[model samples]
Every structure is written in structure tokens, then in C-alpha cells.
Target: MKSSVDQIRERFDNDVERFSNLETGQSATIDAPLCLELVAEAAAAATPEARALLDIGCGAGNYTLKLLEQFKQADATLIDLSRPMLDRAVKRVSAATAGRVEAIQADIRGAELDEQRFDVAVAAAVLHHLRSDEQWSTVFAKVFASLKPGGSFWVADLVAHQHPGVQSAMWHRYGCYLADLRDAAYRDAVFSYVEKEDSPVPVMTIVDHLRAAGFVGIEILHKHNCFAALGAVRPITGG
Candidate 1:
């Protein structure tokens, strides 16, 4: 029997054809190169060369392609709930990494990673689909375990505003942004889809989950209205 999570995964799978188009993903922080630029700025010092990366909810290969482009020889493991999405990501990264890339079709909520180790783990615009905070915490813990000690982790996603006024403002602004980008009917449909299928938390709550998962030196790399990019490292001493 299909679970609720499965239904959400299926919906994302249905969008696979349009998923690869970068423009469809535009938002406050969805720009492909801009996201890595934020990561580079946050890192300041360069990360180790040829290091491995774990990409959670990779979708149709947007972030993976950019990461490989920026970090030559970096290996990547891409995980997503939808196989169709994973297939696209696999083809996208296979040539770039030359056998260094692995793609897995698995849901983050319960998926267990293998012997692969990663220097950094990142997810883009993906976590809001998780049904609850518990699932989010689980994803963090799993990513923490997957990384080598002292490894980095980052995420770019939509965040829910906590205060009533702030939430109202963000929602209205996002609606306006969508309307400007697309049409009014499209904006309304997008809003409805978000309300029904997504569960976004405030940015601090994400940091709290990362801390609970044993990450240190947490950084809020970027936030624009309701979208944000946050990153941190697992303690080398395994704190």
C-alpha cells in the first residue's frame, strides 16, 4: 500500500519533465549558481579537493550539475524519492563525475545511507515536503551520520514564518511574487499546492534540528523573504 509520503513522491515524479528546466525553480534562493556562491562565501576557505558530497532530494539534477561544475573531481551521491527524478540526476552527473556519482531513489524520511562518506551534504528546496518536524530531524540525523566528522552540510529551502503577522506578510508577498512571475491563476494554484503538500518550518527550527543532529558552527548563509540557505559542520571531534 502506498503511504502518504509515497503520494507526495509520486506528485513530484509527475513533474519530472519540467523538473530539469531551471526557470521553473526560480524563487528567492533557487538560482543554481547563486546557491553555490553562497556556499563558497560561507566556507571562505576552500573545501578539500575531490571530496564527496551527498545531495538529498536532488530532484532533476539542478544542484548536482552546478556542484560538479564548480568543484572539479568532487564525487557525489544523489538521493531522491522519485526514480524518474533520480534518473534525470544520474544522467546529468554521470559524465561530469566519471563514475564518481551514485544515484539512489529513496525517501529521506526513512532512507538509510550506505558505506559512502561525504565531506558535505546539501538539499535544495526539498525539505518542505517532509510531513513533520520528526521527519526533518530524522533527515538531519541521517545526514550527520553520512558525513565524515568535520564534514559540511547545507540546505536551501522555503521557510515558514512563525509570527502571525510575519507569516501573513510572507504569504502575501510570495503570492505577489508568483503572480508577477507567472499569472494570477498560476499563483493561486501554486499557493494551494504549497498549503496542501508542504510543511515548511522557520529557519531557526532547522538550525535547532541540525544542532540536535550534532552539527556545530551553524551558519545562516542566506535568507530572502521566506527562502533561506543554512549550513553547518559536523564536529571533527564528534561533539
Candidate 2:
């Protein structure tokens, strides 16, 4: 069975220090630091005049902090499932940005975001936890609703492959990367947790969801191994 939400929260609550570093990002994820930079730069380029930011599953707020460097005057809203994670993100983000920081301890699946409120929204290494198609659709739609016209939403996360052979090949590569990063034990542990907790979808699936969510100008920023980063903009011409 998949890990329960409470279990996921408990795990993150104790792992704040691992996620606190902006330099490495989540060490377990492939090209974590690169994706961080990519997402931040892409968001800045896409919404150069952004004045407000929303970070779903903010974790230690690394993504938000990076974006703050670009949107120096933008207020930030951070949401996460673990209070400790949220607290750490708030502390770090507040220190980095002169703009106001708002932290909410809640899952993205059910978080109530105000409509047309933000210029940029980012979700990093977080959406993979979404288990069902409906959950994915709902969260995408909600994130869409929360952004202002011409706003953008960015995502960097592990992604699945539609073909079984391709998925296996990617999974194997990811496993080798993990083993090389540490040891076989570490790789097994990471694999075990993913099997029990994650339900990532393919990059194409995400694109379809974004299209259905009313986003335009979709762009795939990066993809390496099993990870990918992408963004889509809400059209200024539409409601």
C-alpha cells in the first residue's frame, strides 16, 4: 500500500534539515540544483514583472527563495503538509525576501487558494505524491485558478514513463545514480520509499493536465533521467 498522508507528513517533519540547503536542493533528486536554477530563471523570464508568488509544497522554501532573487519585491505564499517544513521554509524565505511571506500548513490537494491572486506558482518534488488522476486534475485546476492572468506555474518533479520498457530503463538508471551517489543500501532505501509513497505521472500527462486546466504557452524547461521541469502560463486574454 502507498504511504498515508500522515506518514508522509511525519517523514518530512523530521527531515527539514535535509531540505534546508538551497545549494544542493533535495540531494536524492537528480540534478536538483540545476532544476532549481532552471525553474527560478524560467519563472523570472516568463513573468518578469511578477509581484506575487505561490509555492505549493514549499518544503524548506528553496524554490521560493531562488525566485525571490528575481522577484525582489514580490510577496510569497508557501504551502506544505508538514508544519516543521513549513516553519523552516517561512524562516528561510522571510530572511531572503523583503516582501511578506505567508505560510500555510496544508496539502496541495485540498488547499484553498484565492483565485487570480499570484503571478507565479511553483511546485518542486511535490506533485509526485498525488495518487489519482482526479487528484492531479483537481490540483492543476486549483493552481490554475490561483494564478493571475498572464501568470505562470512551474513544476520540477520525478516523472513516470508510459511505456513499461522505458519506465524500467529509466528506473534502472535512477537506481544506478542513487547507488553511485551513496551505496546500494541508500539506493534500496530510496527505492523502497518511492514504491510505498510516490505515484508520478509522465511528462506528457502533465502537459495534458495543464492544457485542460486552461493554461497556455506550456514549456518544458528540463528533463534528465526520471526528473523533469516544466511551466505553463495562464493567458491574459482569457478568464
Q: Write the per-residue lDDT of candidate 2 for residues 1-239, one digit (tens) a residue.
A: 89999999999999999999999999899999999999999999999999999999999999998998899967999999999999999899888888899999898988999999999999999999999889999999999989999999999999999999999999999999999999999999999989999999999999999999999999999999899999999999875
lDDT of each: 0.76, 0.94
Give the lowest summed-lDDT range of ten residues in model 2: 65-74
Where model 1 places Cα greater than 4 Å from the true spot, the runs are 1-3, 22-33, 40-46
| CA RMSD of each candidate after superposition | 2.7, 0.7
What is the alpha-carbon lDDT of model 2 when measured against the actual structure? 0.94
> Residue 161 of model 1: what lDDT?
84
Worst 10 residues of 1 by lDDT: 23-32
Measure candidate 1: CA RMSD.
Answer: 2.7
Q: Give per-residue CA lDDT, model 1, range 55-125, as digits (tens).
A: 88988877766666656677788999898999988887786776488888887777888532887788888
| Model 2 clashing residue pairs (backbone) | none
TM-score of 2: 0.99
